[model samples]
Structure formats: C-alpha cells, structure tokens
Target chain A: MKARILVSFKDSVLDPQGQTVRNALHTLGYDAVQDVRQGKVFELDLSGISKAEAERLIPEIAGKVLANMVIEKYTWQILED
Target chain B: MKARILVSFKDSVLDPQGQTVRNALHTLGYDAVQDVRQGKVFELDLSGISKAEAERLIPEIAGKVLANMVIEKYTWQILED
Candidate 1:
C-alpha cells in the first residue's frame, strides 16, 4: 500500500518559519501574498499492508511517531499503486 | 475565497531537511521510520475573490512566487468559507 500524509500547523497557530517565508516573499515582490504556513509531507510505501489497514493503522503511527499532536494536525490519503 | 496549497520536492529529489528529520527520529527512537521529507503548506484567505477565480489564478501565483519549478511542485484546492 501507498499513502500520502500531510501534517501542518493549524491557522490559529503561529509559525515562525512561515513568517520568515512571508517576509522573504515581500522582499521578492510577492506583496499580494498575505500569509504562509509551512508543513511536512510524507509519502509512505508500505508493501505488506492493505489500504484499509493503513488507514486504521496510520493514525496510531501519526500519533505516536509522525506528528507532535500538541502543535500539529495531520490528514492522510491512500494512494493507487 | 480561500485556498490551500502544498508544495514539495518530488520523491525523486533528495531532501536535506527531510534527511535531517529522519536522523532526528532515529535518535528519538523511531527506528521503523526509514525516511522523511519536509514541505510547505499555505492556507490562503483571499477575500474579494471568487473561489473559481482563485483556483484559476493560483497556478500562476504558485508558479511565480510560491514554488520554484526546478525544485518544487505544488497542488491547490478551494476551501469552503
């Protein structure tokens, strides 16, 4: 099975790296851009598992090792492989 | 209008930041994690624009100021108010 997971800070959270990017954008002349938030993308290849199993299993994986739940939230999708 | 965009290096491309994260994970005791890739996410609140217009225009925005074509690729989706 294959999965693509995206984890990010919610809108309400402050992102220092994103603020830096926004500042850089302004310097680069993209003034229309008002805000930027940075996140992590994980593309996983789990050969022995089924997509159904992955969906159930990944939340635990994400909770335990993939994301810091205090500051991050995640969503995942099963991929066609 | 609201739009969410995500930008990342292609799987074929090497990610130094991701590698760093994987190394950190190993040190923190996530031995099952083989790799990690980092990316950027943008949650845009574009007022005075229609979702349709935002979707049509974001490709140009992403291409011009959001991501470097040589190193990154991105996808965007319209959001409910």
Candidate 2:
C-alpha cells in the first residue's frame, strides 16, 4: 500500500514563504498569478501493512508527526497501486 | 482559473529531510512505514487568465522558478473550480 499526505498552512495563518514565492513569480513576469500557497507532500510506502491498518494509521502519523495542527492542516489519500 | 504544481526531488536525489521524517515516524511507532519522500505543492490562483494561457505559463513558471530542474521535477494540473 501507498499513501500520500498533504500538509498545508490553514488559510487564516500567514504564509511568508508563499508570499515570497508570489513576489518572485511577479518579478519573473507571471503577473497573472494572484496568490500562491506553499505546502508539503509526503509519499509513503507501506507494503508491510494492510489497507485497513494503513488507513487508520496515516492520519495519526500525519497529524502527530507531519503537521503542526495549530497552524497547518493535513489531508491524506491511500493509493490503489 | 486555478492550478496546482507539485515539485519533488528525482528518485536519484538524496532526500535527507524525508529520511529524517521517516525516522521520526519510526520513533512514533509507525513501523510499517517502509520509505518516505517529501515534496512541495504550490496552489495558485489565476483569475484573470484564460485556461489556455494558464496551461502555457504554468510549466514555464514551475520549471524556471518553482523547481530546480537539475535535481527536482515538477508536474502541474489546472483546476476547474
């Protein structure tokens, strides 16, 4: 089994890194870019675990280790392949 | 229009950050986790641009600014919503 976890800052939080990227894009002539939010993606391989076990563990892992729940939110999907 | 850009290190690259996270997961008792890869995701909002223009510009933006082509690869998708 494989899983993907996306960890991103909540909309309410300020993202200076994102702002910096947006500014760089503007300077690079991509003026049409209105906003940019940067996030993290974690791809996990779980060949030893069952799908049900993976489903149950992924969110726990994402929250406890991969994300800072106070400022970031995480979503995850189990991969079929 | 909106688009998503995913930037990740190529398989040949050494991802110490990912290895660190995997170690953390192991410490947290997710022993089934075999491997982990970390990447970046950029969510972009482009209300003033047409879909065609966005398609043309996104890759240019991603390749030239968002990713280091020598070590990382990027993929993008246009969002309908």
Candidate 3:
C-alpha cells in the first residue's frame, strides 16, 4: 500500500509564494490566471501493511508530523500498488 | 475554472528531504513506512476562459514556470467550478 498526503495552508492564511507565482504568470502573458496556491505533497510507500492498517496510520502520521495545524491542513488517501 | 498542477522530482533523482521524513516517521513509530517522497502542488484559479483555453494554457504554465523540466516531472488537470 501507498499513502499520499497533501498539506496546504488554510484558506484564511496569506500565501506569499502563491502570490508570487501569480505575478510571474501575469508577466508571462497568462492573464487569465486569477489566483494561485502552493502546497506540499508527500507520498509514502508502506510495506507489509494491510489497507485497513494503513488507513488508520495515515491520519496519525499526517496529523502529527506532516502538517502544522496552526496554519496548514492536510488530507490523505491510500492507494493500492 | 481551476487547474491543479503536481510537480515532483524524477524517479531517478535523489530526495534527501524525503529520506529525512522517512527517518522521522520511523522515529515516531511508523515502522510500516518504507519510503517517502516529497513534491509540490499548485492550484490556479482561472477566470474568463473556456475549458479548452484553460486546458491549452495549463501545460505551458506548468512546463514553463511551475516545474523544472530537467529534474522534475509534472501532471495537470482542469477542474470546473
């Protein structure tokens, strides 16, 4: 099994990096782009674990280590490999 | 319309950060986690554009500005709002 976690800033937080990307796109002629948000993706390879176990583990792992709850939130999914 | 771009290092590239994450997970008692790979995600909001036009623009934007073609690979999808 494999697990994927996406960690991103909450909607209320300011994302300066995303803003910079939007500005860069404008300079490059992509005027249609109105907003940009950047986030992190973590793919974990789980060995010798059942899907049920992985499902239970992912939340704990993502919550405790992968995301900063004060400003960032995370979502995770398990994949069959 | 919205577009999501996922950028990750090529499989052949070394991911020290990922290794660090794996090590951290192991320390935290996640023994089933064998490996971890880190990547980036970008969500862009498009305004005043048709789906076809947004589709055409996503690749150019991801390839030219969001990802480093030499060491990274990117995948994108368009979303309806």
Candidate 4:
C-alpha cells in the first residue's frame, strides 16, 4: 500500500511564505494570479502493510506527526499499489 | 481558474528532511513505513485568466519560479472554478 498526504496551514492562519510567492509572481508579471497558498506533500510507501492497517495508520500519522493541528491541517488518501 | 502545482525533488536527489521525518516515524514505531518523500504544493487562484492563458502560463510559472529545475521537477493541473 501507499499513501499521499497533504499538510497545509489552516484557512484562518496567515501564510507569509505564500504571500511572498504571490508577490514574486506579481513581479514576474503574472498579474492574473490572485491568491497563492503553499503547503507540504508527503508521499509514503507502506509497502508491507495491509490496506486496513494503512488506512488506520495514515490519519494517525498525518495528524500526530505530519501536521501541527493548531495551525496546520492534513488530508490523506491511500493509493493503489 | 485555479491551478495546483506540485514541486518535488527528482528521484536522484537526496531528501534529508524526508529522511528525518521517516526517522521520527520509525521512532514512533511505524515500521511499515518503508520510505518517505517530501514535496511542495502551491495552490494558485488565477481569477482573471482564461483557460487557454492559464494553460500557457502554469508551466512557465512552475518551471521558472516555483521549482529549481536542476534538482526539482514540477507537475500541475488546472481546476474548474
């Protein structure tokens, strides 16, 4: 089994990195860009685990280790292997 | 239009951050985790662009600004608004 996880700042939290990127885009003349949000992606290879175990572990791993619940949120999906 | 870009280190590149995370997960007893790779995600809201223009610009933006072509590779998809 395999899983992909996305960890991003909560909507209410300020993202200075994203703002910086947006400003860079503006400077590059990509004027159509209105907003930008930056996030992290984790690709996990759960090669020896069963699908059920992987499903159970993914959320726990994502929440407990991959994300800071106060300012960041995580979403994950099991990928077909 | 909206575009989501993913910038990841090429397979040949070393991902020290991901390795550190994997070590943490291992310490937490997730032995099933065989490998981990970390990447970046950028969600861009292209409010005023037409689909054709967005298609043309996404690659340009991703390649030139969002990713270091020498070590990182990027992929992107346009989303319906």
Q: How well is candidate 3 docked (DockQ)?
A: 0.92
- C-alpha lDDT score of every prediction, in listed order: 0.72, 0.91, 0.92, 0.92
Q: Write the per-residue lDDT of candidate 2 for residues A1-81, one digit (tens) a residue.
A: 789898999999998999999999888888999999999999998877778888889999998889999999998999775
Cα TM-score of candidate 3: 0.96
Cα-based TM-score, every candidate: 0.74, 0.96, 0.96, 0.96
Q: Mind listing the fnat for each candidate?
A: 0.34, 0.93, 0.94, 0.94
Where does the lowest 10-residue lDDT sum fall in candidate 2 chain A?
A46-55
Tens-digit lDDT track for model 4 on A1-81?
779998999999999999999999999899999999999999998877779888899999999999999999988988776
DockQ-sorted candidate list, best first: 3, 4, 2, 1
Higher-lDDT candidate of 1 and 2: 2
Q: State the DockQ of every prediction.
A: 0.37, 0.89, 0.92, 0.91
Q: Comparing candidate 1 with candidate 2, which one achieves the higher DockQ? A: 2
Model 3: CAPRI class: high
Give per-residue CA lDDT, model 1, range A4-66, as digits (tens).
Answer: 777888667898987887787679855655776777777654555556666776676676767
Predicted complex 2: CAPRI docking category: high
Residue B50 Cα positional deviation in candidate 1, in Å, after optimal superposition:
2.2
Pairs in steric clash, model 4: none
| Model 3 agreement with the true structure over A1-81: per-residue lDDT tens digits | 788898999999999999999999999889999999999999999998888888888988888899999999998988676
Question: What total of clashing residue pairs does each candidate reach?
Answer: 0, 0, 0, 0
Per-residue CA lDDT of model 4 for B1-81, tens digit only, reads: 779898999999999999999999999999999899999999999977689889999999999999999999999999776
Off by over 4 Å in 3: none
